[model samples]
Target: MLVQNSLSEVLRAREELFTRTIWTDPTSQLQNRVKGSELSRYFLLTESERIGIEQTIRLLVSTTPYYLSLSDPTDPNCPIRRMIVPTAEEAVFSLEESSDPLDEERLSPVRGLTHMYPNRVLLFSNHSCSVYCRHCMRGRKVSSSGERMEKADLETAFDYIRNHHEVEDVVVSGGDPLNLADARLEWILHELNQIPHVRICRLGTRNPVTLPFRITDELCKIIERYNDDNLSIFCHTQFNHPKECTKEAKDAILRLLKVGVSVGNQAVLLKGINDDEEIMLTLHKKLLEMRVRAYYLYDPELIPGSRGFRTPLARGIEIVEYMRGKIGGMGIPHFVNDLPGGGGKITIGANWYLGYYPKTRQHAFRSAVTKKIHFSFEPVGSDKESYYPVLSEADWEKFQAE
Candidate 1:
C-alpha cells in the first residue's frame, strides 16, 4: 500500500511540474518540450503531416507538466504519448464510426444528464478537462469547446433528481468534474446530498492524473463536508497505462482517500496502450497500492475517428480468463462492453460453460440480476424460493412409477 508521509517535498515537486503544463495548442505543447520546433528530432512527421492532424480532429491538448515529464521523446510508440498526443492517423476516418456511438444523446432526458440505468443517472456538469485524451468516447460532443451546465440547467437537474426518486445514484461526469470551480462542484454535491433517496454520488474525472493540484485541501474538505452517514461520495478516475501512476498522481489520490472520499479506477482497454495482460495487471496492482479499486476495464466504444484505438473482443476475454484463476482477485476489474445502440455496459468474460452447463445467468457472486451487483433486487434475493420443483410425496411416488 502507498502510505502517505510528510508530502511537503512531494507537493513542491508536483507544483514545479504542474507549472510546466502546456494547454490549448499542440504547437505550444511541442514548444514547451525539450525540443518542440524540431519535430524531426522526436517524431518523423512533415509540416503537412502535423497540419493534417490539427485540421481533421478537433484537437484540444491539456497535457500537464508532470505527465509530459514522464515521456521518452525518442520512442515514437510511447504509451504515454499515444494517450494524449494526436497523430496523423486520426485523419484516417472510418465509415463505421459515429458522433455518439453509445447513443447517449438519444437517452438524455435533460441537456446535461444521460439516464441509462433505472436507478442511476449520469450528470454531465462540465465540458472541460485537465488533458484532452485522444481516445475519449465523447470526443465529438465534449470537445471542451462546448459550454458547461448553466445555473438554470443545474436547478433543472436537481428538479429531475427530486422528481425521479428512483435515482439512488448519480455519476457526475463530463470532460471532468474537477474542471469546475470548487464552489460549483460543492453546489452540485450539496444539492444531490439534499435528496433523501440519493445514496451514492460518483464523480468521473481525470484531474488527479493530469492536474494533481485540483484535489486540493479545500476540495478534500468539500468532499468531507458533504459525505454524511446517509450519502456517500466517491471519485472515479481513469489510468490506462502504468506510466500514469506518478508520485504526484498517487499523492492526489491519497488526499482523497485520507478524506471520507473513496477512489476507484475505470481503465480504457486501448490498443497500443494497456492491451497486454501483464501490462494491465501491473497498472491495476499499482492502483490498489494507492488504495484505488480497479473497477472497470471498458471495451473501447465504436466512436467516430477512434478506429485506431480499437482492440479485439477476444483479447479482452483472454485477459479476463487469465486473471480469473491464475492470479488473486484483489485488484481485478470487470471487463465490460458498453454495448452499442445504448444497450448500456455489459460485463464480458471467458465462456462460463462446463461442457454440459449453459452460459451463466449469475455473476461471479451468483446474483440473478448480475448487472445490479450490490442491490438485493428481485429473483436473486432471499424472498425467492431456495430450490425449485418442491415435489409432494404423492407426486414423487407417481413419477417413480411412471
Candidate 2:
C-alpha cells in the first residue's frame, strides 16, 4: 500500500515537473538554483548542492538541444526519478547491472546471513536508509520488498553463525545499520559480543554522513563496551565531494574516534561525481583530518541500472596512481573492483612494482660485496627484473652531475 501510494505521488509529481520543463536536460540544470523561491521549494534542492546543480544546468542549457526541448516526463527532477525511470540512461545502466553483483545470495545459507570469505560473515539487519543513494547496490530491495530483517530473522542468522565455528569475524551491515533504534542496536552488539568466536565486530553504516544525529553519546557508550582488542567499527560512507564533508559529519566521525571505534570509510567511485584525482585526494585528506582511516575507494558496483555511474577501470587506476606518492600512505585507500558474480573484492590499483622483489631478512640484496658472508645477492637478469631496480652508483653519479 505504501509503495502504491508513493508511486502515485511520484507519478503526479512527475507530471508537474515535466510540464514546467524541468525534466528537459537543459532546464534540469536549473534544479539547484531554484531554491527558497517557487522552483526550489518544489524541487527540494539543498543549500550545499544548489550551486553545483545550477552550474550544471547552465552548461547543459548551452550545449545540448535534446535536453532543452524535453518537457515534463511525469516526475520532478530528482534522483528518485532518475533511478526508477526505465528509458533514462541510468535506467539502461541499471538494466545491465545485476542485483547480486557478487552473487551474495548464493552464499546466503539462511535468511539474512552471507558467509563468503573464510572466518568472516556479512549480516543483513535493517534494509532502509534515511536517504537512498541513486547508485545504491541494494536499491532493488530496500524501500520495496526487501525491508528490515525482523528480530527473529536476525536471531536465526545469529544461530547460524554460532553453529558455524569458522565464522570468527562478523560484519554487520544492511541498508544502513545505523537506522536501527539505539536500544535495538545495543542489544545486537551485546549479543554479538557474548559470542566468543565472533572476534571482530565491524559495522557498515552511512549514518555518520546521512543522519549524524542518530549517533548520540549514549550510542557511543554502548559501542565503547564492545571496543576491546577485537571489535572495530567500519563507518562506510558515500561521500563524493568536498562539499559532502560537512562540519556535522566531521563531528560524528570525531565522536566515533573518541569512543575508540576505529572509523574507516568506503566511497563509491561514481562518474561525474568523484571520478577525479583531486576529489579523491581531498576526500582522503578530510577523512584523515577527522581521524577516520580511508578504507576502500570502490569502483561503482554493477547493480542493474547503475552502469551510468561507473567510472572506467583505467580512470580509477589513474586516480590511485596520482595519489600514491603524492599523499601519506595511511590516507591512500585501496582502489578495488568488486568482481561480478561473487569473485570478491580485488585490488585494481596501479602496481608500483612491475615484478616482485623477494624480501630477505639480514642484508640488502645489492651487488656491493663487503665483509658480509652468510648471505649473497642473486641477480635474476634484466629479463627477470622484479620491480624497478635501485639506482646504480653510476646512475646516481650521472644524475648528480646533471
Candidate 3:
C-alpha cells in the first residue's frame, strides 16, 4: 500500500520514461519483442558471442524492449543479459536434466491443470511471455506456441475445480498469466471468483520485473474487482537480483498493493545471477521496501539446457544460512527445492535442531543468527504450567495499574 496516489500519475510517469524510446506503446510491447537473431540489432554482440547464442538457442528466445534496455550491451556477463540471452553452455546437456523434471504432465488431472496438491491446483492460463527466460523450468511448454486457454479448455478446468470441494486454492500461472488480454484475463478471474469453495486465487507472473508496463490501471481494476471477502487475490512474481528492482518495477508492485492484491516475490537462485549471499540479501531487502514479501528462494530445477544456471545444492543452503539475521524475518524467503519427478517441494536450509535428551528432558538447538548453542528443558507430564513464570501478588497489582 505504498503509493496510494491516483492511477494517472503512475501511467504518466511510465509514459514519460518511454516517450523517446520505441517502448512508448505499453500494450504492444509484447508483440514488438525482439527474438532470436534479431537480438544482434539491439545489443552489440561480438561475432563469437553471436554464434554462441545462435548455436545454443533451443527454447524460444525473446525479450521485451523494456527488459532489453536494462542490459549492458558491452558486457556479456551482465546479469540481466544472462537471464534473457542464451550462451553456448546451454547446448551442453547433463545426464540428470529432463525437459519435464517435475513430471507436471504425468500428474495433471486435466489438460493444462496440474492437481499436484490436495488443496491447490495450477492452471496454465497462457503459453507466452514478454521475455522468455533462459533458465525457465517449463521451457518445453512455455513459449513453444503462442496459445491461450480456449473457452472449452477453461470450462473443463473449471468443472474439475467445482467438482472437487477440497480445492480451496488455485494458482493461475503460465509462460505469464498477465500476457493474456485484459478481457480474457478478467474472464478467467470472473470464473474463478464464481467458485464458492475457492478461497485463494494467486496469479503467478514475472511482469513486474520483465514488463512493468503490463501492470496498467485497467488490469489493476480487474484484479480489484474479483477480490472480495469470499476470495482473496495474490500476485507472485520473480525478481532474481537487486538490479531488477527498478523504479518501474517498484511502481508496478505498489500498484498491485494499492489495490487489494497481496504481492510477493519468488526469486530463483541462479548460478551467475544471484548465487552470492550479498546479492540475494539485497534483492529481498529491496522487495520488502516496495511492500512485497519475500516468499520463496527456489533452488534451480534440473531443466534441460539449464546446467549453466544451476548451482550446487550446498550453494543455496549457504546463501540462506548467511542471510539469517542480516535482515528482518519478513525479508527472508524460505529456501526451497521443488523436487524433481513430481516428488513435491521441501524446505531446505541450515538445520537448527541439534538433539534431544530423554533422561534430562532437554532439547538443544544452535542459533542460526548468533551461532550459539541453547538448551530448553521440557516440563514434566501434565505440568506444563511449571515452565511459565509465576507473578507475585505485588507484581500483578503493578501490571494491572500500568
Candidate 4:
C-alpha cells in the first residue's frame, strides 16, 4: 500500500528526473501543454513529417510537456511520439471509417448522455483533455473547441439518470472527466449518489497516463468521499505502451488505490505502438505491480483518421493467447472489440475450443501449454444429454444402463 509520505517523496524527486517546471500543478501542466505544430519544438521532425502533422491538425494535436519529455526527439518511430504526433497516413481514410464510429451520437438521447447499454449510460462532461490522442474514437468532439458541460447540461443528464431507474452504472467521460474542476467532479458524483438506482460511477480519463499530476491528494479525497458501499467509483484509464508506466504514473495509480478507488487500464491494440506480445506482457505486469488491474485490451475502433494506428483483429487475439499463462489471470485483460454502429463490446479470443464431436461423444480443445489438440469424453449420466457416438452393441447397452 502507498502511504502519503512515499507519494510526497516521489513528487519531491520529480524535479531531479524531469526538468519540467509544472510537475506538481495540474493547471500549470495543462496551460503549458504543447499544441499542434508546437510539438516540433519538443520533437525533431522532417519537413514532410511536419507538413503531414500540420495537415492532420483538424483532429487536434496536444500533449503535456511531461508526456513529451518521455519521447525520443531523434527517433520518429518512437512509440511515445507516434501516439501524440499525427502523420500523413491520417489524411488517408477508408469508406468504412467514420467520425462517430461507435455511433455514440445516434444512441445519445440527450445532448451529451449516451444510453447505449440498458443499465449503463455515458456522460460527456466536457470537451477537453491534457493531451489529444490522434487515435481517439471521439475525434468529432474531444478537444475540438474547449466546450464543457454547463450546469444545465449536467442537470439534464442527472434528470435523465433519475428518470431511468434501470440505470445502475454511469460513466462520467468527456475529453476526460479528470480535466473537470474538483468542485464540479464532486458535484457530479454527489448527484449520482442521490440516485437510488445508480450503484456504480466510472470516471473515464487518460490523465493518469498523460498527466499524472492531475491525480492530486485533493482529487483523491473527493473520490474517496463519494466512493462507498452505495456508489462504487472506478477510474478507467488508457495506457497503450510500456513506457507510459513511469514512476509518476504508478504513483498516481497508487494515490487512487490509497483512497479505495479501483484503477483499471483499457489499452487499445495499435499497429506499431503496442501490438507486440512482449510489450503488452511488460505493461500488464507493471500495472499489476502498481495494484491496477488489467481490464480490457480493445481492438481499435473504426474511427476516422485512425487506420494508421489500428491493428488486425487477429493480432489482438494472438497477444492475448501468448500472455495467458505467462501472466497472472488478474493481469490478463479481456480482449474485446467495441462493434461499430454502437453494437457494443464483445469479447474476442483465440478459438481454443476446437469443437464438440457427437460422433465421439467428446469435446475437443487446443491445449494452451502443449499447443496441441486434446479431447475429453462426455461424462455419463449428466443432467444435459447429447446424442452419443455409435459403439459396439455391448458398449451401447452399458452406456444406456449408466
lDDT score, candidate 1, position 116 = 90
lDDT at 341 for candidate 4?
A: 83
- Between candidates 3 and 4, the one scoring higher on TM-score is 4
Write one digit per residue (lDDT tens) for candidate 1, span 283-326: 88788888888789999887756766899998888776656654
lDDT (10s digit) by residue, model 2, range 1-402: 001224455445545544654322222323322221222223333332343333321111111111211212334433232321222333243445676777888989988788889889999887765545556776655655445598999999999888888888888887677767778888888878878788888888876765565567877888898777655544556555565576767877888888877888788787766788998899888878877777888888877655556778898888888887667888888888878888888998664432223442111221112312232344644444344455455544443354
Off by over 4 Å in 2: 1-87, 93-96, 229-234, 355-402
Q: Rank the candidates by lDDT, best first.
A: 4, 3, 1, 2
Top lDDT: which candidate number? 4
For each candidate, the alpha-carbon lDDT, in order, equals: 0.71, 0.62, 0.82, 0.83
Q: Give the Å shift of residue 39 in candidate 1.
A: 8.4
Cα RMSDs, all models: 10.2, 11.4, 10.0, 7.8
* 10 residues in a row with least lDDT, candidate 1: 354-363
Residue pairs in steric clash, candidate 3?
none
TM-scores vs. true structure, each candidate: 0.78, 0.70, 0.87, 0.89
Choose the strongest candidate by TM-score. Answer: 4
Q: Rate residue 102 of model 4 by lDDT.
A: 88
Candidate order by TM-score, decreasing, is 4, 3, 1, 2
